[model samples]
Target chain A: MTVEKLYDAAGFKTISKGDGKKEVKAIFCCDMLSIAMSKAPASGCWITVVSNMNTLAVATLTDVSCVVIAGGVAVGEDMKAKAETEGIALFTCEEPAFETALIVHDLMNA
Target chain B: MSEVKLSYTISGDDFTRAGEASGDVKSKLKVLGVAPDIVRKVSIALYEGEINMVIHAHGGTIDVTISEKEITMVLADHGPGIENVELAMQAGYSTASENVRALGFGAGMGLPNMKKYSDDMNIETRIGEGTTVTMKVFLQ
Candidate 1:
């Protein structure tokens, strides 16, 4: 499914404009930047509560479909700016990280 | 002979700046039309190395050299060296602090991941002096 479709179904708030049509290959849930960078699929969506600038960096480096910050984590202004500059889609939701991953997984499987 | 040599210092004090050098190198390689797979390999290896420098060592320097045949990276740090390189090489071993783990790192996969992504990797260290990791990814 496209990122936009997932966003709509998952009820996530978009923080940056990206190609919503980008394919979603999988869902990788991890707060560890190194692990995500190493294991995240090319078109995966990373689910995490660790809302730091490095989150965007890892997402960009791995070429993930988008990043979903869970449980309404406070994203820094610098991180938002960097996400826009890097062209990586970012979103946030009130759900916890695990719940968010499950939602994305169900969406993908649907 | 092919070209491009770049070097950057990683500040141990700033966790946020850890991956900047690897990201820069990845962009440069992409601009040079390096193959996507090679770029990914180089990026992952260098990024893992960069994170290790910040989380373990106080900081370090990463030097990258790209030639027609391969891309090579050398990361050297003067922080507390690894007490046991073999144990550290084991997949799940880690000496990172709780604070580092809370940041979503310290899974003990950094070096192993680097080795997995690069075609070749080597390490040299002295317990008090520091550690230097050398890795190379072939263009072919």
Candidate 2:
């Protein structure tokens, strides 16, 4: 599915509309950057509670289609700017990472 | 015989810029027509090394050379050297502080992941002196 479609279906708040047309093929949930770095699939939607600059870096490195910041984590202004500059689709939601993953999973499978 | 060489100075004080070097290398490799998997592996390995330099060492320098046959990365740091290379190589081993963990790193997977991605990995360290890591990813 496309990032825009996921945003609409999941009802998550958008932070950066980077490559809204980008296709997402998988769902990965992880907060540990190292694991996420080595394991996150290309073009996957990442669900994580960690909101930091490093998150964007990892997203870029892993080539994730989008990053869904869950658990009500507060994203830094610098991170938001970096996400925009790097063309990384970013979304934020009050739901915990697991709940967000569930929603993404259902949408992806449906 | 033709190759592209890149170097960067990693700053220990800036947690936000840890991956800049790896990201640059990733882009360069992509432009160079390297395979997707090889590019990812090289980026991941170099990124882990960059993070380690920021967290463990005060800072360091990374030199990358991309050639037709392989990509070589040499990371050197002047911070307090690793106490035990063997233990550090174990998965789930990390000496990073709690502050570093809050940033979503310090899980002790940096070195191991570096090794996992590179075709050949070597570490040379001295107590109270520094450490140097050399890694290569072959292009096929």
Candidate 3:
């Protein structure tokens, strides 16, 4: 599904403007930046609770389609700026990471 | 063949800046038209080393050399060196403190991940003196 569709389905608020039309290849759920960087599928959506500039860095390096920060985590301003600069798609939601992951998984499987 | 060299200082506990060097190298390699797999390999290897330097060592210096056939990264640090190189290299062995673990790292996968991605890797360390890691990724 496209990022826009996923955003609506998962009820996420966008922090960075990625190509909303870009198709997501898959969804990866992890808070560890190293493991995410090593294992996340390129062009997939990353679901995590860690809200930091490093989150943006990992997204940029791995070329993820979007980052879904779950659990109502308040991402810092610096991280938002970095995400904007890197042209990475970053979003946040009130739902927990596991719940968001489930929604994304169902969407992908649907 | 001509080569490009880059260097950066990784400050200790500076989690925000940990991946800066590797990101720069990845961008340069992409601009140089290096193969995707090779670029990914070098980026992953170098970033792991950068994280290690930040958490274990009190920061360090990373020097990268990019040639037509290979990319070489040399990371050197002046901190408490590894007490057991063999054990440290094991997949699930880590000495990082709880604080480091909370940052979502210290999972004992740093060195092993670095080795997995690099074509060649070598570690030179002295318990009190320091540690230096050299890794190379071949372009094929």
Find the candidate with the highest lDDT and give its number.
2
Question: Per-residue lDDT for A1-110 in model 1, tens only?
Answer: 88987557656788886888999988888877778888889999889898887787788789899999998887788888888888888998789988888888888888
Off by over 4 Å in 3: A106-110
For model 1, the superposed segments whose C-alpha errors exceed 4 Å read: A6-10, A105-110
Q: What does candidate 3's lDDT look like per residue over B1-140, in tens digits?
A: 58999999899989988899889999999889898888888888888999899998989999999888888899999988999988988987888888777767777889999999999999999989899999999875
Per-residue accuracy of model 3 over A27-108 as CA lDDT, tens digit each: 8899887788799888899999988877777787787899999999888888888888877888898899888888887887
Question: Considering only chain A, what is the TM-score of each predicted structure?
Answer: 0.91, 0.94, 0.89
Clashing pairs in model 1?
A31-B104, A32-B104
Model 1 / residue B133 / CA error / Å: 0.9
- Cα error, residue B57 of model 1, in Å, equals 1.5
TM-scores for the candidates: 0.92, 0.97, 0.93
Score residue A74 of candidate 3 by CA lDDT: 88
When summed lDDT is taken over every stretch of 10 residues in candidate 2 chain B, the lowest stretch is B12-21
Q: Can you tell me the DockQ of model 2? A: 0.92
| Greater-lDDT candidate between 1 and 3 | 1
DockQ of each: 0.71, 0.92, 0.67
Q: Rate the local accuracy (lDDT) of all candidates.
A: 0.88, 0.92, 0.86
Interface RMSD (Å), each candidate?
Answer: 1.1, 0.5, 1.1
Docking class of 2: high
